[model samples]
Target: MSIKKPLDPGQEAVSLCQHHPREELCYSCSDCDGSLACPECVTSTHQGHTLVKLKNTPDFVWKKLIEHYIQKAEKFEIPKILKELKFAEGKLEQNRKHYQELIGVVQQRGEELKEAIDRITMRHVNTITEVAKENTVYIEYYQGELHSLHTEIIYALRKCHQANDTEDFSVVLDSEKIIRAGLKLPRVPITQTTKYRMGPSPLPLLESAFGGVEIVGYRPKQLGPTVPHVVQKKLEKPEPPKPALYSVVSEFRHLTDITSLVPTEDVYSWISNEEKKEVVLLDRAGDVKQTTGLSLHIRDICTSPITNNLWCCSEYDYSVREMTTPTNTEVRLNFPFVPRALALTHNEDVVVGTFRKVCVYNMEGEEQFMASADKLGRQIVASPQHISVCPTSGNVAVVDWDEQSHDGNGSPCVTVLTSDLQLLFQYRGPQTRALRSGKSRASSTRKNKKEPPPSFWPTDACYDAAGQLFIAERTSKSVQMVSNDGTFMRNLYTDQEFSPKTVGVQTGGFLWIGFDFGIVKVIKYKQ
Candidate 1:
């Protein structure tokens, strides 16, 4: 401390002020004369001299200067301005849509009013014109009576003078016919009647009792298209400006990963009156965190035609999973890993629909068949459960999403394949018109063009014991029954309101219908 240079009053006292950034712990000397120092600076000088503080000191001035710069940067930020602009644009679009709706309503009301006025006017005009024609006949009769008059006419002339003028003939007209004609006038129902003048009698029938030319009410004219219907656009208050932030645009999908779905309580069993046996239980076991129920993600399950140990799946797992149980009544082929859809061969070899190709597997966990990469080009949307497979002589008959998915959701047709899985022909069901015109092709067998009835959306399909295809339509809320050779048959629904998710056949046309909340149906054939 003694070796340190002493600060002098004549020279600059190099120290910071009390108002510096770290001033809370600064605790500097009161008379330090810290012109060149920070607020944390301490000093031993200015012990007892009369001190005068600077007005609008440099520390305060520097703080204000930094704050001014920050405020300027905040005003010019792009994100802040862009946010306000977007809000304004969104409000304007909403106003436009609202105004458009109001304009449509007003236009419709105007048209309705115009048509009503036209109908009433035609009937009223015809009735009024007939009354005017009848008055002409009455005037002719009065003139004829005057021509046949004798010296009695002199007395009639004196009576006419007493009545005021001869030409002013005001006699009370008899009008039973015209009064009946007024009764025939069309009645117009008016809504919201206020400030409108209506005749006290509603007709000219009481004109005889009143005996004066009195105007009862005004009639409305027919409305025309020239009338401009006005609808004001409701303007809203402008939203506030936002703080600035950085942003960038990217193309790839950032969709959220879908975790396991939680199972809901409550299931109901459905049955036909003929069978009377409850096959599908509402509260099926093994869905939640438990054993003895079915495995996870098993949408639709089908037993293999060749072996009792093998089964295929479409909804739950990607590849086929086989059970290694000793009894072997269980499912036993877990080979393909991630099979969205699966079909069994007559020998129980599994054919699975994958992301790009159809991977065929044997019971020994070997890849027996791998189709070409373009075997199903661009057909995998929503990751490939969308394609339905109908297996034939060791090969696959595929109906992909390439056509009906992109163009329409309707079931287009099933493609047949040979033993080598070559495309043989496209079968549009037995009903041609329904296939082309969107009618239920499987429901009707008619050969002509007809109005279509409601149908199903087939997502996954397989054949039953009768060599018939049971198609699980995603949207039809039912399964379509078709022959294995690809002829349209009928539709199967578990319940009237239950939507069909996945379908498979075990034996005797025994089909399993999958619905919501882990409930599956075991159906028995009726006819």
Candidate 2:
């Protein structure tokens, strides 16, 4: 006669539904409480119900179930169970051997007592000693076998999980096949040798013997931490709200050409790059308060909102200088490349934009971090012409000019980065029709093909008190306002009177726009 093997769930070929066994179940009905459905069923019975496709679920329940069992065996259950079993088996073997030795000693003592005591008492002692050892050999044999089987089971369990985890189907199949065949515990039949009988004690001097049998209970030791330590506390002083800046305050027009501007609490400092004599500091009324003269040829300047210390970079010396006062000037750090632009971070670090990359340096001139390339290993800044840091978010904004872009016109784009130099996004501005310059289309095509004009050639950028970025393009006279996330908000200015070059935000939220012809506008651009 032929025999059949039972079906295994692991090897079972799953079907669509119990009723429509041929069709595959691809989706589950959401409204009908997870009822299995095929495409045909979706149109029929489950037409109105929202359907969730099986393919959409990244992790299947079967995979999770297998993982759970494996974790239980490896991390918690198997090791603990095996340890306990081994401990119990050791105690059982030790007790059994100890009892046999004790029986031999007691039997020798009983033989001596048999000579001294009456014949009846001697006979009873012999019967009792024999009864105590009748099941010792059989019980010990069973225990040893049980321990061996437990060890095998533990090994098998570990191997099965390891095979399952490694996705070794053949190993797992072989293991489960052996397991299902059943490795039962060895059956031990106890043979009755002697009956339970009262006996004269071998150790007659001691009334109660056999280690004074006692049931000792165990209480598990507590593993929780006894000492409570507080790690975090709520901030006592919350940050104050940022003031709104709306509309232009006043247009501060100057006679000298202004290259860069930095706003302090009481005054605004404008650097005339054309002149090497001094940096002019003016009050709100456009009155010159002081003119700080230094040895460096200032390319850009920035003042801290917290501290009114003036920081300026020189193109000729390739160094950044910090000026606490007009007379007190110190060369902070010297760089190989010229520092084109500068921004002061909240922690008083100076973010210097060099030829190739943007670098953040502390007050002691120690380099903290840099943004030379993006997360995907793509170079972010080609020529970091201008840079700005958001006071609130600490996000670094840079206007990089691509020197090799578009037949030498230089394609410029703004890059927004986190304080840690992670590239959040790069804004290239709106995709508009390119405005061609230089040669005629036909003539350029005949000689060298003409390319589109650079869309955003931003010369400088500054962040307002509310963390809004203002980009000043070289091509346009207007200053474009952008959100901290690089979203273009609106044009802050579009006037023929001034051609905006570099921009700065004053302490009281005034937008300071410096023009090529020494025209500086101190306008409020936010509400």
Candidate 3:
């Protein structure tokens, strides 16, 4: 679009070159647009006009315009066509490589499939052929005997009529008698016995004769169940001396899901003496077997440090109870809300957390204090299992899990609260966000909504041997441990699997897992 050209003729100031020297230089009009009229008489009137004194016809300007058109054609059209042609060539090469590689894999797989088909077809064909051959041999032998008997019958009958005396006395046997005898006759001269193994064929063929001829045959009889007879041999098993103290003398099946694991001083003694330790377990259906009123769920269970007895929380019964060895009894108690987690502090106070509050009780189930609830709103009431009575703080740390997601309902959190229901500190991890903001929370509880609950559900929090706090997350298939400060520890998975419906730490420094079934295991760490 630009009009300027590269060539510059600085000034046309000189009076048009008047001399026609060398027969090339000529005078032109002061203005270059048209021919000059007789050299314009050399006047100053056309001084500012551009003048041309060319030495040749149609000089540089016309040549420059032709050059610009040639460049535009080469740049715009030729290079684009070349790029497209190269791209097509590369695409074809790539396709060839792809088809070659695919051909080998397909051919190899097809061959294997063909061989499998052949093997299966041949097995069936061979079996059918074998059975047909056997039947043909049997028919030929029987038919020959029947034909011979018929021929002999005719000759004997003729001889009897022509005998004229008792010379040929005995009667001739007909084909019918021969056939009957063939079936009944035993081995007069010993013959090999033949047994046919059954194979695929029409049922009618099994009874019909070869060559489609009719023959006499008998139906087989039915038999009873077969048994093998053998001589008897006996061996004795020696009995080991039973340690009356540690042996499991009784077993209860399907009685209850084991809810707590309690280890004994006797088991600890065995551990110190370089022997395997045995753990005792306690489980409950959660009451005095009452059928009415509030239905109690066995939320949590623990062993009393002072009495070595089992204690469990029951929502229906609203009670905490101590059970004597392998047996439980009802103890009247009241909890602030439905108890979900239970903790026994060093001072022996029973700490339990439920909807929006933590309640403290004595060994006898008497209320000590109704701890904090302000920080926990309707949004966060009860955690699955995260009520830990901190020995260091004497304050309870309750981990709520709903708010961390910034969800209307699912603010997942762990709040440190005082003994008198006062809010102190709060901790939260990443929470699954609410699918719809400014919506009701109850909708989030639906199973298929958005985020599924993690496999790791909180179970209990306690101190390790070093007094460092730790936590347990349990499931039907796994049990994992994490530091009480919410630090992740190594996950435990392998060999033995336990439902770990609940967990407890033994006074003997072992970890106990409670199964949903009526079984329990104690994992003792060497370290």
**Reference-based TM-score of each model:** 0.33, 0.48, 0.36
Model 1: per-residue lDDT, tens digit, 350-439? Answer: 666554345566777678766432244322221234223333334355544322323323334444444444444434434442232112
Task: Give candidate 3's total backbone clashes.
Answer: 16
TM-score for candidate 3, please give it: 0.36
**Worst lDDT window (10 residues) for model 3?**
269-278
Distance (Å) between predicted and true CA of 430, model 3? 12
For model 2, residues 166-227, the per-residue Cα lDDT tens digits are: 87756656467558877887898576765442222245344333234344697544323442
Best by TM-score: 2
The weakest ten consecutive residues by lDDT in model 2 span: 434-443
* Model 3 lDDT, full chain set: 0.47
Clashes of 1: 25
The window of 10 residues in a row where model 1 has the poorest summed lDDT is: 270-279
